[model samples]
Each structure stands twice: as C-alpha cells, then as structure tokens.
Target: MHEFDLIRQIDSFAADHDDVKVGIGDDAAVTSSNAYKDMISCVDTICEGIHFKRSTLHLSDIGYKALAVNLSDIAAMGGTPRYYLVSLGIPAEWDQEEILEIYRGMNDLAKRYGVILIGGDTVSAQNGLMISVTVLGEIETNRSLLRNSARVGDIVFASGTLGASRGGLDLLLSQGLTAHRTEEEKALVIVHQRPDPQVTLGELLKESGFRIALNDISDGLSSEIWELAEASNVCICLEEEKIPISADAIKLFGKQSAYEYALNGGEDFQLVGTVAKTHWPTIQSTAKEKGIRLSAIGSVEHEGDSQVFMQKNGERTRIKRTGYRHG
Candidate 1:
C-alpha cells in the first residue's frame, strides 16, 4: 500500500460525489440521505477452515470477499446498500497494518457502491479469523424483488459470465498451470478475488412491467437455479450449452472441466434474474447498458418436478450436485 492508499482509492471511486460526509481512514463513515420507504437488511459470515483455506488466499482478497458476499445478498433483493457493520475476530498473531489492509479491501468495495461502514466490534480469537458483516439497504416500500415471483412464460437470465470464479479457483489450486497463461487468467483471478455485485441490474429489474424472481449466483449455477425453481414451485428447463460461461476460463480448462466448474463450483456472485417473455428485450437492453452479459439459460414451466434440466440432441439430461456444501 502507498500514501493515502485507502483514502485515495475511495476518492477515486466516488470522487465526483458530494454526499460522502465521511469515507475511508475515518473512525466512522457518514452518508447523505437517499429516498426509501423501508429498509432491507442481510448478514453473512466467513470462518476460516469453513469458508476458505487460509493458505490459499491473501488477506486483502478475503476482506474484499467478505463484504462482497453480503452485498450480493442485498443485490439479490433489489436493494441499495446504505450501510455496513463488520465484526471481526482476529488471531493474535496478525498485526495492526494487516488489519488495516483488510479494511482497505473492504473500503475499496463499499465505497464503490456508496455503502458506508457505520459500526461494529472487533476482538481476538484463539483460532483462525472469523468475519461477520451485516449490510442494511433500502428499497421502495413494496418494490423489493422476491424469490417467489417467477411465473410461467417468464424468462430467466444471468448477468455477466458464469464459472469463471470456479475456474479461477482451479487455477489457483493447481500449480501445474503452464502455457497459454496471460491476462485472461489474471482476469479470472480478479473475478474470484473481487467479485462485482449486480446492484444496478437488480434495481432495473425491479422497475415496472417485468416478472420478478431474483437470486444471486453465488453457489454453483446448477444449485442456485434449482433453488429458484423450488422457491417459485416450477420446473426450470434450460440448455447447458446456452449458459453464458467465460470464454477465457473455458479455454483455460477444457470443455468438461469448464462445465463442471460452472455447475458445481461456487462464488460467482452474479445475479440470476427473471423477466416476462414480453420484457426480454428490455432485460437485454438494460443488461447491455450495465455491462452485464444477460443470457437466458431457461424458463419456468407450470408446477412440476422440482428440478432443472438440460436438453441435448433431443434428449434430457438431469443435473446432479447441490453446489458446494459441507456435511
């Protein structure tokens, strides 16, 4: 880190805004008012040996991911994150600068979305670090996106590409990486390190005239899609070939590897949103403007088996795996 590294980074992110009463390097942050009828709140935590392997990740990336994952929850609900509170149990071995670096990463992400850290508590743990973050956001009183709103004839779409984060994890785990290594691999590392939550796209979907079931693709796409179908009480019929996977990651890992990564691997954090058949064009247009690759992987059918399917060569293939889980 350099001089005013955190502060300058925050300024660069929101340099043009006047509503920032306080930003990075402050004991506390403050923000100006924004209109909202009710607030939505979500909290998430990542414990070492549970959420991640300490040997495999950098402290800064861990910090960024801690905030990003919670923000994904807020994004899935079509809310704007207004405030965040972080509680950390650090190991005694870590130093002050190391703690600051974690804040530095969190600051980098929170300020990007106008989220301010309001308050929290910190303490030392005897074991690995555990981070608990709660994000409070707001949506227009009755306009929040619900997981139960998907209807027949509604088209389901995902923002950005899938499986890249998973592939990136593979790349990080396998030291055998050689040849064809370039900036593309680096991009996957960035994707896994600092995921971009789709807050803006979720807001756009919450606008009038669109069918409204929404969820974030944090778990493997296969599992999350099944979750949506279960929530809405419908069948999701889609083609695996049509899912928007990262070209770079696919090239990096052959077809089967890429497909497995997309289906079972986790941590993409993109939005899996639904829109009416009539509103598909609007959905596409909105995604284009937001720089999110909106692709329709499937559609909801009238209540049937609680499953997601892939059609290939006039036959059906049932998907397995409930995403990354612990016993």
Candidate 2:
C-alpha cells in the first residue's frame, strides 16, 4: 500500500485542489460546473465486500459497475452526464491488467452515455479493492428534477422494466456461474454486471418540462418511491399490476421472486420519475422517442405517514418494507 494516501493528504483544507477547476477532495473527482443547462454532480463508491465482490465478478464487470452506478445517480436527477472522474484503490501486488480491465468497464458505459473520464487519482489500498466515480451532467435548470420536487397528485413512472439484476445475481451465486458456463446465462449475468443507466430517458424528462421527484431504482422500486415520497412530503400508492416487471426477468426467476426482487431489490438502475398525471401520454411518447419504455406504476398522494401501498386485485396492502438501507 502507498505510505501516503494521496486523497488523505489532499484532505487538508489548505490542500484543496481548487486550482484544478473542479472537485478535488471528494469521493469522486468532479468539474467546477457544467456549461450547458443545469449541472448535476453525483459520486458513488463500490467496495470489495459491500458494493461488489472481486472474486464473484470478473475484472471487467467490477470496472463497469463502478462507474455505471454513478451515472445512474445523474439519471435519477434527470440530467445528461457529460463527464466522469475516477479513483482506484488497488493492492500493490495486483497485475497491471487490473487497471486496464477496470477502465474497459468504465469506458464501456462512458461510450453509451457520451461521457468522458476527465481525470482522477490512484493509490495502493492497504487491503481490499475500491473504486469510486463522480459524474457531472447538464440539464435545463428549470427542468432539472430532484427527489424533493415530487408533488401530490403526480404520477410515478419507471423507465423500462425491473428485477433482472437481482435475479441475475441470485443465479450467478446459486449456480456458481464460471466464465465458461455463464454463456447459457449471459443475459442474466449481464443484467447484474453491466446495467444500463437510463440517461436518454432522464434527459428527455429534463427537457420536456417533466422530471419531478427523480430517483434511480438503484436500490429497489419500493425503496426509491419511499424516498421520493419522503422528499416530496407525500405518500406514494403503487399499483402492483402496473409495475412493469420484465418477462425475461420472470423467465429467469419465478414470479414471486421476480416481483419481490423488482419491488425491494437493488441494482436495477432504472430511472424513477414523477410528473403530472395528465402528461402520461407525453412521457410515453417521449420515452419511445428516446428508445426507452416509461411505465406508470403509481401516484403521489397528500402528505401523511410516509408509506407505499401496493394495490392488486382491487385490494390495497401496505408494503412492509420501503427499500434497501445500506449499513
């Protein structure tokens, strides 16, 4: 491990890398500000034990998800991610290819979102592997959505389907999918490893006078909706029948597992947005125009005890858990 932590040395207030023209002493590096529309900044961390397991995943997947998670945050805020800053903590004895493989993953996502990895710092970790990324995005200021902007009477929408990630992870672990045997489960494995951040859809919402109470389903649908309700000071009533669970996901995992996985699972990385009920058609058309599917699953109700209700078969039941809470 490197004796001096570069990030730690920069932690001193006097050492703030302000001259660099962007974020310095933070989780992921960032730029000063976005030139176009509104600027959004978000950073996410993936660790060996918590966010991911190196042995359980390939080097490429570990690299891709490390940055994809941050991009997902930008999408949740309804912004167009333009740049990324990456930091890596590696073991001293690790092979040189480790770094390249990680970049391969990050670059794979950056290519899809049209973002660039502007800069970052690297250092030796005393123990396990760690990767952090910060992404900066642009959006129209007035249209830039946030979690707190959710409003009562607004419709809750999710981009594309959900639950494939959780299902994929389960299959990989339960079946011990090796690099050789995973081809049969390629789609399942891909969902868990290389999740697509809904940037286009998020940008569409930002430009179309939509985008209120934005959040990405990184944790789970129920969890994100609960957060939106808390931020907007409202209650979200989700229709179970309306929640868009993907058919491929159901085929990979059974109905109950898939439904719960979609509801309370993590890492789906879908965009969840709120908007006026009347604008449903526009959202749909816009999503289609952008090549994403937007599904309306619920509505925001007047402020009360924060809770999410799942309605099925004309019966509404309180969902005991809202979403995942990271320790």
State the TM-score for model 1.
0.85
- lDDT score of model 2? 0.75
lDDT (tens digit, per residue) of candidate 1 on 1-327: 443455456567755456544343211223444554556676778998888765546787788899998888778777788899999999999999988888888999998999999987889999999988888877775566766678888888888888899887776667433325478887787788788888888777776446578888888788778767766778788777778888878899888887777777779988886678888887788778867678888887777666778776668877764753210
Q: Please provide TM-scores, in order, for all candidate models, with all chains considered together.
A: 0.85, 0.85
The lDDT values for all models are 0.76, 0.75
TM-score of 2: 0.85
Q: How many residue pairs in model 2 have overlapping backbones?
A: 1
Model 2 per-residue lDDT tens digits across residues 1-327: 332255445545434554232232211233334443545677777888877876557888898998888888777656678889989998889988888898998898899878998998888998889998878876654455667677778898888888888877877777665755434367767888899987777767776775466778888888777767765778788998888896777776778888988987779999887888888788788779767888889888877667778888889987775544321
